[model samples]
Target: MTASYVFSVRFRLSPDAAVSVEPETFETTLYRPADPPGEDGWLFFRDNLWRGEVNDQRHARRLAEDALGVDVEAVEFRRFETDREHYDALKAAIADDLATFNADSVSEVLNKYFGSSVEVVS
Candidate 1:
């Protein structure tokens, strides 16, 4: 079986090397293989996840490298998991985060972690 959800990769870029075309929100499509022992699920993967922002990680890294001259790493990703209820909760969490994200304190923390280039687009 396959499950889809929105994913985000937050990163920073050097001042001298950053892309003029900034991304608002990134999307990722997750594939849940039908198998037992699902408890062994690993959140991080090299590929097989699809995002509307760009292609594979290789492509995303290349874009960052070419445009910003820096390697873009996967800081964190938002996935709802294999359960429908959990997925819905994830969506709600995202929305709540968005609501409180623009606050001064939140921005401060986000800027510290993700830098000023932090952007959210869906």
Candidate 2:
């Protein structure tokens, strides 16, 4: 079976921006296939946090800059395997949001949470 993971990134914005900005954060789900598995890649699911693509570090940085109208000072990414326990907890925590997407599975809920920007790594 493919390995599943949750990916999250935290971004700090430049201080000189015109708009008052808060730290930007995003999360996504990644699916790593076992076959032809040279490097894990993104899974473009319809449902996601930004509702647009935020696949990689560069994309996340760009999104933050664009949304905040400021340069990105730093970005930190955190990833964790979506083992059964973690998945269950996540599902419960986001249960209300998942209902909006009509998601019945963990993958579907993750897709709704992270959209097309989901990344995969081995």
Candidate 3:
């Protein structure tokens, strides 16, 4: 099972750039893996998100710029997409790591980190 934070990135393309595009502004998606809970990168939520949203737009754009090798102008979070199995596993892991987060329950952790932006797919 795998999960990823989907973001919509807007970037600028120079006129000298060799591409068959109409506009200078372009949009694309970048997936940041929401590593399995309790894993090394499990703190992604705490580091990058607040209330189910991106905490820093500029930082996110820089990340997109690095990944796309383009000048990113904006970044917007789309969704946290995952499967049922992965979601359940995350819940279980959160329950295990409750103390570190200083939260009372898994639901609280979810709310604080993800809000209502989670999308579970089959």
Model-by-model lDDT, in order?
A: 0.37, 0.43, 0.86
Clash pairs for candidate 3: 52-114
Task: Pick out the ten consecutive residues of candidate 1 with the lowest summed lDDT.
Answer: 43-52
Q: Mind giving the per-residue lDDT tens digits that candidate 2 earns over 23-85?
A: 443333323221211223222222223343333557655754675565554333333344444
Q: How accurate is candidate 1 locally (lDDT)?
A: 0.37
* Colliding pairs, model 2: 47-115, 48-114, 48-115
The candidate, 1 or 3, that scores higher on lDDT is 3
The regions of model 2 sitting more than 4 angstroms off are 1-52, 55-70, 73-86, 95-97, 115-122
Writing each residue's lDDT as its tens digit, candidate 3 over 2-121 gives 899998888988656565567879888889888887779878877888887789998888888888999999888888999998899999998987997789999998889888889999
Better of 2 and 3 by TM-score: 3
Rank order by TM-score, top first? 3, 2, 1
TM-score to native of every candidate shown:
0.22, 0.28, 0.87
What does the lDDT read for residue 14 in candidate 2?
46
Ranking by lDDT: 3, 2, 1
lDDT of 3: 0.86
Cα error of candidate 2 at position 109, Å = 1.6
**Residue 61 of candidate 1: its Cα lDDT?**
51
